[model samples]
Target: MNAAEIARDVSARRVSAAEVTAATLARVQAVDGDVGAYLTLLGEIARSSAARVDERIAAGEHLALAGVPIALKDNMCLEGARTTCASKILEHWIAPYTATAVARLLEAGAIPIGKANCDEFAMGSSCENSALGVTRNPYDLARVPGGSSGGSAAAVAAGEAAIGLGSDTGGSIREPAAFCNLVGFKPTYGRVSRYGLIAFASSLDQIGPLARSVEDAALAYDIMAGYDPMDATSLDRPVERTADSLRADLAGLRVGIVREFDTKALGERSDALYREAYRDLERLGAELVDVSLPTADYGLATYYLIAPAECSSNLARFDGVRYGLRVEGADVRAMYDNTRAAGFGPEVKRRILIGTHALSSGYYDAYYVRAQKARTLIARDFERAFAQCDLIACPAASCPAFVFAAKSDPYSMYLMDYYTIPMSLAGLPALSVPCGWTVPEGGNLPLPIGLQLCAPLFGEKLLLGAAAAYERATNHALAHPAQIGTVPA
Candidate 1:
């Protein structure tokens, strides 16, 4: 069941929260071994939380997400749960407090089933970077389910959870959603509080949701987004009810099509899928208008500099003096070096080196400062484009999910986020919905393709509503992986 149905059924006393929780847990236990979506399962906490929901239901309280089982990306702190971010550096580190987003989920009566695995410190484009384990795509175990929110997306796609909360910085959530054939929403920066979220790139990281349908994503977003005094970057604006804004008609909405996106950069099949998406939107009453975002071409370059620099600064706190793994050495400097070398994965180390160098004395202006300027240009481009259209349409990625190790080089893997990083750079709201499916050569199962719809800052209601319209017109959201109902023997 979707979160809405679960909440309604639980509130109407048709099914107890405990029963729903048990079923969800059973589903995970039966299939998680093959999917490897979770690093830890909060079975006891889930049951206790479900009991609380039942009690609230009995008292006539209408919780928004009553009894809905959800999975949290390991990067978000849930007090007493191990928030490892799928990195060995903090493998056993337990969070001392819950993230503001998570606190909201609990208040709305959503049960967290476990900490979903992710790329170590949310650094890579594939779950292969995870020190914990590789999370296989449900559609094809040999292929990747995108990253750093791959596990969260996979859990939702495989029906292990009703919804999954993920953090997006440079397409972490959206790319994974595209790969897993699920709906992923990334709110404008500061729209959601980041108080207890483990920082990857502080400015770029935003908490969002991955779900089987657009409405489910919107429902979760509504409950999680709002002003939080605890998070200084949190927007002070009034919270909007996105779920109520869902509509099945586009009518006069003008959707912008990025001219750069229609070029030969995408694969033949992917380009065909993108064209089909344009037709699908037009059929649903949307007016497609050509638009240009010249600066978007530099998004990947700009993000690499800014994100790594921020990550280098934020991750500095994990030094041996504070918490996490600590290795002994001859002196303090040696100890710090030894601990970091042993704790961080290859990708994390590479980024740290690049970031530290970029922020170093002589190169700051050449790298970091220049990147910030490019970021502003990207934002300005969006502002201008939004004036011409209500939302922008593009492919979620250049291609569909690739087989594991398809991108052995880091640079090639970075290009996987080409279609997604621009919006993150602009701090805008973007949603990825399953538009269609494509079967790769020699591949038996069809892989899902995602269509990304982006809106200007604070335009989530419009963004989600349009996605809902497309979803209603074409029931692509109803498609699920063949492995969703089965466990590998």
Candidate 2:
């Protein structure tokens, strides 16, 4: 059952909060060994929270998300919870304060089942970079569950949690959601607070939800999203009611298809899938028009430079002098170098070095400044495109879920996110909905594909409503991963 259905069943007294929480916990225990979704399991805390929810329900008290079991991405802080970003550098660090999102969910009576694993510092596109272990795709154990929000996506797909929270700087949230055949929503930059989230690229990072359906995702978003005084970048926006916005009335919804996203940019199969998705949207009363976004052509190049430059600065705090693992050396500087060298994974080190080089005084203007200019143009492109259309439709990523070994080459891995990085640069609201799957028969691996819907800044209402409508039309939201014993039949 979806999150809405589960919450309704509990509220109507058809099921108890304890019962649902137990089922969710049991499911996580049963399938998590193979899925590798969670970095920390909060069994005792979940049960205690479930009991409180049940008590409130029994007393006829109102609760927005009472008894709903959800998983949090490791990057989000939860007071007293072991919040590791799947990095050995801070493997033993426990959060002393909770993130606004996690705190809000708890206040709404939601039970946090655990913290899901993620790429170290939420840096990689594949969970393979995690210090804990890779989070396998629910559809096929050998394939990757997209990252750096891989575990959050896998947890929702495997039914270990009703919903999960994930962060997106590039396609971290949407890519994983596409891979796992779930709904992932990335709100406009600053639409959600980043005060307690482990920083990756502070300028572009945002927190959102991943769930079985768009409505569930939106519901979670409404609860967790809002301005937090602690976060300087957070926007002071009121929480708009999204559950009531899910309607199938797309009478004048103008949808644009970026001409830049041609077959040449994406491979043959991906292009075909996108064409089919456009047709599907057209059938749903959306007018699909070709729009030019020249800046999108340089999305990858700009992202690589900007993201790493920011990462290098943000990561300078971890010097083995304070929190997490430390190594003694000949001196303080040597100690800092030795600790970082030993603690960070290879991929993390690579990005840090790239960022450091880009930010160096002599090279800053050539790399960082150029990337920033490109980013400005990219954002302006979206602004121009939005004036021509109410929404934009495209493939969520360049391709479907790839094989475990397919992304061993860094360039190939980087290219996989080509279609996704643009929206992040623009800092707009985007949603990824499961369109269909590739390798549909004869093999255990079913490659899930997603159709992305993007809207102008702070236009989540339009983006999420469109996704929910598409979801209801195709019944993709009801589809669960096969072979996962925890998934509902």
Candidate 3:
């Protein structure tokens, strides 16, 4: 069941919250071995949380999530639970407080099943960069579940949890959602609080959910979106209730097809599939119009610079003087160097080096400041595009979930977020919803393709309504893996 169904069943007293959580945990035990979706399982805490929900329901209290099981990306704090961010340096760091988003979900009676695996400090395009373990696509064990939210997507796709809370910097959430055939929603920047979430790129990081259905993603988004005094970056504006406002049709709304993001460039199959998806949307009452983001091609270069510079600054706090892994050295300076060298992965080190160079004495203005200017122009591009359209539609990823070790270099890997980075740079709300299936060459099982729908800042209601309309017209998310997901059929 999706989050809404589980919540309905549990709240109606037809099934207990404890039963739902237990079944979810059991599924994890049976299936996670092959998928490696979880970095840490919270069985005791999950059961306790579910029992509290049951008691509240018995007391006649209404909960939005009401016993729905969730998988938390390891980067989000859960207070006392290990929040590793899939990195070795902080592999055993127990969070001192819960992330506001996680707290909100729990307040709504959502039970956390485990801490999902991710790329080291949410850095990689694929889960391969995780130092501890690898996460496989539930559809094909030999393939990858997209990252840095790979584990979260894997958990949801494998039925171990109803919703997977993931943090998106570039395309962490959406790319993985595309790979795993789930709906991953990245709310507008500041729509959700950043407090208690370990920073990656402070400017671009946004928390959202990966779910099997659009309604479920909207439900989670509504419960988690709001102002937070704890997070200075949190948006103080009134939050719209998107789940309740989801429309059955996209009447009177214009959906933009990015001129720069043409589907034909992705190949004939992708072109045909996405054209069909757009047609499905048009049939559901949306007006399709052409829109262009001239700076879309520059998003990748701008993102790498800005995100890495921010990462370099944020990660400076992880010196040996603080909590987590400590590799002893002859002196204080040596200790810092020793600890970081031992803890951080290859991808993390590469980004840090690039970021440090970008911020260095002779080059700060040359790279860092220039990237900031480019980001402003990118934002302007989106602003102008929104004037012509309500929501933008494009491919979620360049391709379907590829086999493990497919990308040979970092450049090849970085290209995975080609379609997702611009929105992240602009801080707009975007989501990837399953649109169709594709059979890879020599592969029998079909992999999913996603149609990335983006909206102007705080346009959650309009964006979700259109996506929900498209989703209802095409129930692509309902499709399951033929005969895989860590267990025998």
Give Cα-based local distance difference scores for all models. 0.90, 0.86, 0.92
Query: What TM-score against the true fold does each predicted structure earn?
Result: 0.98, 0.97, 0.98
Which parts of model 1 are misplaced by more than 4 Å?
484-489
**TM-score of predicted structure 2:** 0.97
Query: Candidate 3 regions off by >4 Å?
Result: 480-482, 485-489
Q: Assess candidate 1 and give its lDDT.
A: 0.90
lDDT of 1 by residue, 326-430 (tens): 999999999999999999999999899899999999999999999999999999999989999999999888788888999999999999999999999999999
Candidate 2 to native Cα RMSD, angstroms: 1.7
Give the per-residue lDDT of model 2 (tens digit) for 1-489. Answer: 788887887878788888888999888878999999999999988999999898888899877788889999998999988887899998999999999888888888788999998888988777888998778888887778898899999999998998989999899999999888899999989888898998999998999999989889988888888889999899987867787798685667989998877764566666677788777788888988888899898999999999999999999988997778898899999999999998899888988999999999899999999999999999999889988999999888767666677788877888867878999998999989998767743455557888888999888888888887788888754454545654752
Clashing residue pairs found in predicted model 1: none
Between the candidate structures 1 and 3, which one is better when assessed by lDDT?
Answer: 3
| Per-residue lDDT value at 98 in model 2 | 94
Candidate 1 lowest-lDDT run of ten:
480-489
Question: How close is each model in CA RMSD to the real structure?
Answer: 1.7, 1.7, 1.5
Compared with the true structure, what per-residue lDDT tens digits does model 3 show for residues 328-391? 9999999999999999999999999999999999999999999999999999999999998999
